[model samples]
Target: MTTAERSGAVQDPDARRLADLGYTSEFHRDMSLWANFSLGFTYLSPVVGVYTLFAVSLALAGPPMIWSLVIVGVGQLLVALVFGEIVSQYPIAGGLYPWARRLWGRRWAWLTGWVYAIALLVTIASVVYGAGPYVSSLLGLTVSTNTTIVCALVLIVLVTVINLGGTRVLAIAALIGFGTEILGALVVGGWLLLAEREHDLGVLFDSFGAAREGSYFAAFLAAGLIGIFQYYGFEACGDVAEEVPDASRRIPKAMRMTIYVGGAAATFVCLALVLAVPDFGAVISGENADPVGGVLSTAFGDTGAKIVLAVVLVSFLSCALSLQAAASRLMYSYARDRMLPGSGLLARFSRSRGVPPYTLLVAAVVPAVVVGVSRFSEDAIVKIVSFAVLGIYLAFQLVVLAALRARVKGWRPAGPFTLGRWGFAVNVAALVYGVAAIVNMVWPRTPDAPWYDDYLVLLSGVVVVGVGVVLMAVTRPYRHSDAAADDAVRSTAAPER
Candidate 1:
């Protein structure tokens, strides 16, 4: 089928689309841009990205952690360009789902949306897990696994409350949290470097020899794949595309810019960590034990470190809130499309709050289950998160590649945020990187790691996508609403911006 035949038309073709979609276009384009960056950077800035960079840098690349960051950044940039092009053309909410449907056909589009939605749910779960350690550290208490699980639930509830309030509140919180996270990263990273000015830079830069001999390439590849998680959530911008003014142009520009900025910042922070904190042996060992908390403890001293830990805690909470905000909209979007089991329930948007409360509740449950399971074993939690990230990446790549194919076949729309003529080259690079990451993800480095767990995440992801496909397959044909269906799907299909 031609691209236009495959992808559904934008719902709400008229000016009253926002009212019909259960939201007002009250958010300005700048707020939309900041909100996207706020969610994207808060999760990475001084918290998640820091920990991962530290582990990989110390264990795999040494000071060259920047290399992995650069590689992953480039890889994501390619994908972001594709998103940029698509967002400019389709600038509605339910960004990827609609884009996928338009480019790949409705069946594949349904599957894409489902996979993206579940992937975010799993992200919320895992990021909540990342936050628990910081909460415990902030309070000066030792945390048992049980306590961690409890903390995770409390966080989930908190984020859920914020999300159910509406997009505006979430956007405001994201702005505040984004500033806090960036400042925290700077303070901690800069303090460490200046604090240890006498440390040997050569040692830090050349530490890759310490890993299993000849494993640098594999380690680098794995680290690069893992690094993709750091630069993610740009699509969250697309989830609320319909909520913004001039969405068609602004959404894609915001997405493309978000990747560039987030990637650059991530690169700088990784460099700072390697130069400042050369004790990879200790950091890696501690991360193996406690991940977020372990690294923060070593980076700053006891009295001062607690304050830093508080910043980290807030950052984690912000990330959880961001995920809920994005995921609920996704649920709302899917329900609007009649792609989910409880379409009626998820479709209920509170007039008073102007948000989808039931959808928020549904998104909360998935993370809750994952967090509960996490309490039983640390290894299990890590594997599940790793699997989930890989699954999300796979879905993103597929949608992206499909879009590129559509472009190749001469399906072009006028977009202010065009990637110029270089769009094809960028997409080709993205496709290559994505395929490599997927292949490398399934290959076990450690024997105890189950490939099936990866399959389980993929399978679950596939099932969610299938639900969307099934809705289209089983239901009677309803005329495309431009007002009701795909346009309403906005809450879920956002970019990382």
Candidate 2:
């Protein structure tokens, strides 16, 4: 009883607060506000997200595709506000999983966690997988499926080793990534905008005759993946809530900060590339498959382009690191509650280092296996990664949907942060935006392609959710829990000091 009966004053405030919410502080609470925000910013990785998706979006929707960033930035900001409110109140590890659990119930959380966890793992695979070509180019190796997979595995191992250095190392790496990416974007984007402008601002409004089934709106929606992918890395902040003191207040601000700052950076990068593309017709017509590389090489010459590529590699590394860290926490969260199989093993925490070593391994290993799938077919990776953005959005909507339900049932958000009377309205807007985005993402547009390819995003989502449902029904994992459900409901009033 001695350890159990220690007064709140005897423990770190963050630990005490965790205890109030029925958790012990397993992560080191040494993260400053900027460190927290940097995690999200690095995870967001404006340089990585925009660069990878730029050619695809531009090819699909022309220069006008830049608007997708604005549209998604606004919509996701609404969702971010909703998340800010929920995370401010809960501030638990595993971000979405625990938030869903507290707001709805254990089962709702299981589905949310399952969908989100899968999305995250695949996302990690997608990021590192995409980085393979860059790595090959940088190292003067001939890029091939096998070589790409090798590079991806190497990146995974590197980030995993960095992650095992503990929280401070994670924060430092994130900040370095964030600073480098932003500075690179400013330099590259600014250079492109100022010196290399091939098309004027007028081109942004030109679709270059881009349309799907005679509907540019349809094409635009399909291209919306750029913005969707860029915005999610912000939630990585909330995933490590126990690691940040005053998390209830700081995490929400860090979340919103991530969106605001990341949005600006991403938009700047996209805008610069759009304005700098020397041959838009060639790019959209599929003649210029490597417009991103082409633009960099043309703008900066070989040596300068290589330098920029190095920066992009850093961004990729940081982004993967952040994603792995977030996924590990979600795994730990599930295992801590016995909500998943092998909970005990995954929940194994490093007291000295303050990290979940086993779950971190799971995060790294699963993504590595996914990267290996590319050996069979490179297109297979593309089709699989397409689900990443949609799966994440679907999982996000579920959380938003859960928050709305809890709100409708009179669970007014009670934390240092609240939307006040505006909470319900904002929550509704977030849900509507999320559903609209989900529909846009899942709408099959490519009729000429095989049915499987056209419907890949929707099919992948169904398969992930379907698998989650089957596992839930068979295992009933949520039945065994120590989640402090009662405390979650009753302790909604601004936790103990």
The whole-model C-alpha lDDT of candidate 1 against the native structure comes to: 0.66
lDDT (Cα atoms) of all candidates against the true structure? 0.66, 0.87
**Displacement of the residue 435 alpha carbon in candidate 1, Å:** 1.5
TM-score for candidate 2: 0.96
lDDT of 1 by residue, 1-497 (tens): 25563242243342244443343332233346667667655544446655633554355555555566677777777887788777666655566766776576655666677777777888888888766766776776686777677788999989888877676777788888888877877777677666643255565456435455657666666555446667777777777776666666666766666677667666656655556553555554444533334445666668777888787778888877877777877767666766667677877777667677887897899899988987666465555566667767877887777867766665553455666667667778888988876676665566455665535544554565566566657762233313333321233332222
TM-score for each of the candidates: 0.84, 0.96
Writing each residue's lDDT as its tens digit, candidate 2 over 94-129 gives 999999899888888999999999999999999998
Positional deviation of 419 in candidate 1, in angstroms?
1.9
Best model per lDDT: 2
